[model samples]
Target: MTLLYIHIPFCDSKCHYCSFNSYVDKFELKSAYMEALKLQLQADLGRFEIGPGDILSVFIGGGTPSTIDPALYEPIFKELWPYLQKGAEITTEANPNSATSSWLCGMKALGVNRISFGVQSFFDDKLKLLGRAHRAKDAIDAVENAKNAGFERISVDLIYATSLDTPKRVEAEIAMAHKLPITHLSAYELIIEEGTPFEKSPNVKKESIEQSRRVIQSAKDAGLEQYEISNFGDPCRHNVGYWEYRPYLGIGSGAVGRIEKERHYPHGILEEYIENPHFKKIETLTDEEILEEKIFLGLRSDVGVDEKILPAQMLQRAYLLAKEGKLRTREGGFYNPDYLLSDEIALFMLG
Candidate 1:
């Protein structure tokens, strides 16, 4: 099965810790960018030999896809509808402040079955400190609006481990999230990315690793399953598609796609993409590299690698890990309980 990813690199404002290829001053290029995205999608239909019933999901992520007028998505949707499988999960990421009632309604009407809000936190003070444009109330309102717009699969993002994220604060956030009409929760730790505002004068003081574990336990107690390291149920299908090594088509600036072992990356510059949609660099992954990804990605999520693909030595390693209580065997593969150790496990097995 294949997945489709569309990137919208426009945001009303940039967050302090964000290093994404988003721009606030490129509003004038929005229309052209959308046009280019469509062209790129059209190009993929030809280049990848993809047709109807091939795509399992479509995820439109961004610098804030909510900032773009929902109407702009119509053209691309119309082009993709003929090829969309029945019940395909179509998702779009929106910022709480920008995803108003009308925008949410329009997206829902346009076949967006799932909505993920970039609600970094449900606390106003933390939101402000994170350079988020929305307040806590706005996040609540936005989720309510999405629910009213008929989105049953809704998700929200949360960041923890900052100095401001006390145990009490994390509990409060989890409690609030559990009460919301969301089916998914993506909890992440604050990282001071290079070239980001947080990297220069980082105001964030990280909470202890134990605090992070507590946050995960809290979400699980609230009934959200930890399907991945940082993501809780209802985990987006597009995310699972990646861990399972499902091929996908990537459209728009900074989007990457993989067809079998071949990887495709389009021009990252908005203007450059608009100028030439087909300008992309392609790379083919070696069999060894693909095998490594299977182990690395499988150990990080609920999707486990195929035991049939494991070498005798790696199978022994997994058996040892199981004996150590670090791994479990199920679904004809081995899974790790501690995702943090996934990389190390994969490396050890690779050796």
Candidate 2:
């Protein structure tokens, strides 16, 4: 089964800490971009030899999926309908400000069963600090709107470890999320990425290991189990497919896909992509590189590294870590109990 990811590169505004390939002034190109996406999707579907009922999941990610009209998405859904497996998880990411009731209901009509809202925080001040366009109440209403629109699997994204973040603030944020009709919550730590506004003001991000721990504990207390370091509650099948290294078709500008050992990157520039949606720059991955990714991704999430994939020395190191209780061995794989130490553990195993 193959996973499919569609990228929408238009946003109402760029966040302070976002370095994603998204454009705020590209609203004029929305129609053209959607057409380009279809072009690429058609070519890729044929090239990848994806047959009916072969698609495991579909994730429409973006600058803000709700920015586009659901009418525009109808064609894409029609194209995918025959190929989607029964009960396939179809998700779309939306901003609270743009995810209106009409928008939510429209997307649900197109078979998007899941909606992941970008609700970084519950505090209006924190939202402004993060350059979010929505108010605290907007997020709450958006989730309610999604529920009213017949969405059963709803997710919210929260950002912590910012300068204004405290243990109490983080707890309050989780408390607000718990009150929502959401089945999943993804609490991510603030990473001031290069080329973003936050890069110039590095002080905005106050990295605190304790703060992260607090966020995790709060989510757990709210009944959202931590399946990955930054994720909680029910696992996203599309993301798990990625961690498991399943083949996927990345359709759109700035999107990426991996088929076997080759990674395919569509053009990053919107104009360039619209001109030639079929074009792709491919990178071949070596055996060692793939294994390293598996180890890193596996350790970072509940998806443990399979013992069969590890080399003799690496397997021995995993055994040692398991002995020390840093890792747990189960079902021919080694799992990391503490996801916060995943990077360090991955490095030690690599060494």
Candidate 3:
């Protein structure tokens, strides 16, 4: 079975720290882009030789999926309905500002069972600092509307480690999230990406290990298990699939897909993708590169790496780390207990 990711490159407004391939002025191209998306999906389904009931999960992410009308998503869903496995996890990301009751209901009717709201912070000042269009009340209302629309698996994305974030403030953020009827929470540290507004003021991101621990402890105290670094509560199957190195079909401009050792990238330019959605730039992965990814991705999450996949030298290092209590060995796989040290541990194993 394969996973599917559909990207919507339209946003109501761009956030200060967002460097994702999205545009606020391209609303007029929404219909044509979605149609092209269908064309690409049809071609990919055939090319990938996917059979009925082979799709394991579907994640509709984007510039902001809530920005597009649900009516435009009907045809795409119709095409995918035949291939979706029973009880498949279908998710869509939304911005609290645009995900209204009608929008939430419309997506629910089209087989989206999960909603992940981009509610960065609950404080109005913090929201303004992050350039978010919605206020705290809007986020609360949006999540409530989603629940009212019959969504049970709701997730909220929060950003921490911002200039305005303190340990107390981070705890309050997680507390606010806990008050919501959410099954999952993703607490990310603010990373100033290049070409974004935050890039101009790198100090906007205040990296504090204390804040990170506070966020994690707060979520765990609230009964949201820390399955992965920055992720708490019920695990997102699509995200887990990615960490497990499962092949997924990426549909839409600026999206990516991986099949076996090959990674595929469609045209990033919106208009170019609309002109030829089937066109893709392919990159073949070497054995070393694949192993590196398995090591890093596995170490970062609960998906431990199989010992058989590691070379002799790396396996020896893993065993050493396990002996030192930095890593845990279970069922012939090696797991990292402290996800924050994942990068350092992976580097050691690689070296």
**Over all chains combined, what TM-score does candidate 3 have?**
0.99
Per-residue lDDT tens digits for candidate 1, residues 1-351, read 689999999899989989998999979999999999999899888888888878899999988899888889999999999878889999999999899999999998899999999898988888888999989999999999999888999999999987788888898899899899999999998888999988987768586778878888999999998988889988799999999999999998979989988999898988888999988899999998999999999988989778898889888888888898888888788988887677888888788
> What digit string (tens of lDDT, one per residue) describes model 3 on residues 8-99?
99998889999999999978999999999999999999999999999999999998999999999999999999999999999999999899
Clash count, one per candidate: 1, 0, 0
Q: lDDT of all predictions, in order shown? A: 0.89, 0.94, 0.94
Compared with the true structure, the alpha-carbon lDDT of candidate 3 equals: 0.94
What TM-score does candidate 1 reach?
0.97
Ranking of predictions according to lDDT: 3, 2, 1
lDDT per residue as tens, model 2, 182-213: 99999999988989899899999887888889
For each candidate in turn, the TM-score is 0.97, 0.99, 0.99
Off by over 4 Å in 1: none
Q: How displaced is residue 102 in candidate 2, in Å?
A: 0.6
Query: Model 1 Cα displacement at 8 (Å)?
Result: 0.1
